[model samples]
Target: MIALPFAKSGSQSFLRGDRVHLRAPVGGDYKAWAALRAESRAFLTPWEPLWNEDDLERGAFRLRIRRYQEEAQSGTGYPFFVFRNSDSRLLGGITLGNIRRGVAQCGQIGYWCGVPFAGQGYMTEAIGLVIPFAFEQLRLHRLEAACIPHNKRSTRLLEKAGFQREGLLRSYLKINGLWQDHLLYSLIENDRRSTTNNKGAR
Candidate 1:
């Protein structure tokens, strides 16, 4: 596994973009994260796994943070909270998970935006920031994403980010309590054009 560098403060360095920054979620973020998820429940439920009744509770958020940290330390995943650079408000989250190294240097990318922030280009910019971090920082060769076939917004976002439609996975995941098919998409390191011209964060 590759080691990720961290700042002296023990916080992971930020990945900035034109208007957003992606960073690991801290303890203080629980409130905002919970509020946003609560507010966007309906908007996000369709694309996410079935939520438990206490999914957004503080205890659950703490558990999530602990798991995120463990995954980061184990070099198996990197989770980030997207924030507006201007006001530092949480906008959404993007994660690079299931990292595979050696013969297959790749990972899976997944993301979601606050309902109010959806379609405003936040996730696009966030994805742009994460691509380089995955390729250059994490030394991964490819990133893959999957979404329901009817999720035009997600499919378009993947395409805009330079991911090619690879194939379909029948009943790939149980989303919102039922099996759902998904369209697979991928981006390789050689395909720099997709993210390079997107004005990555400094």
Candidate 2:
């Protein structure tokens, strides 16, 4: 059986490399999250789904928190807020959603990092930390990720994190008020062994 690490209290938390860390989002984060997301609006909108008018509202945040709590209780999703380890500044978020257990044991991964933190390795490091947690701890057998074709930064980050390009998914996602074509990527547990062996040699 695969060894798995379960989150304590809420979804499990971890430091992403020495530079970044991830923890559950709290009520206090609503302000910081809203500000950063606002600043990065133009930068993020193209690849992200259309935001609801009430998205940043305190009531919306409360509802979101409740939903995340229930999802955590049911083992359906794990959401985490990313931060800079040195200052604990909110950078963005990562989530393992659409989880399926049983023989498949799979989930889909999604993420976003604030504009100021973009182009740095923060997102990549966050993904690296989370994928292992999903595979080793959550006992998820396969992981899937999708990115808009024009999202070069996101595609590159996923590649760096060891996900393989699987196929093109026509109109696979709705973003910025329109349907968008996406490239799908996947990583399976079997690939982990070869990857581990290669890393051991380096």
Candidate 3:
């Protein structure tokens, strides 16, 4: 996993991993981000919220960066873009958002990988990078994620990453313009330690 420290000031973080690195979104990334999202629209539309007509426009991208910064400053969210380490190509995006502190100490995680990079384990490693950030730097106690029931790939990914299925949420999220049933999953700070301990005992 990447070892770079997260600067609370929202400065650029170089979270490097084996094949991918994660960093905060920047205005300069507009072109590559847009092209990848545009080309992967068909591949991604099924799982994501409906995109606005101007979602990929430069102006919209600018506002997105602003919102991300605002959330960062407020200590409620963090958004990162995944890039290939070899050439620094944009591969995907991930966000640990809606953080709740003051006892809850929890957050939600979401991500997407462009079609060209899908199934290549980039998002998986990207997820690994964020888990530590959420649990250690942010000191979050729990992390939650949900996806449509039919998205078997996501289910497998979450499970492989040690997230346990919590339950089903009927009409949980609007995806591709329709309400869909989503299966919720969660991981807590102790789960990692328990797994490691079990491995040692074995």
| Candidate 1: regions farther than 4 A off | 3-13, 193-202
Per-residue lDDT tens digits for candidate 2, residues 154-183, read 899989888999999998878998988899
Over the stretch 85-186, how does candidate 1's per-residue lDDT look in tens digits?
Answer: 888889999999999888999999999999989999999999999998998888888899999999999999999988999999999999999999999999
**Candidate 2 local Cα displacement, residue 71, angstroms:** 1.1
**Alpha carbon lDDT at 72, candidate 2:** 68
| Better-scoring candidate (lDDT), 1 or 2 | 1
Query: Which candidate do you rate higher for TM-score, 1 or 3?
Result: 3
Per-model TM values vs. the true structure: 0.91, 0.91, 0.92
- Which consecutive 10 residues in model 2 have the weakest lDDT in total? 1-10
TM-score of 2: 0.91
For candidate 3, write residues 1-202 as lDDT tens digits: 2133344434645577999989988888899999999999999999999999999999999999888888887888888999898988999999999989888999999999999999999999999999988998888899999989999989998998889999999999889999999999999999977987999999
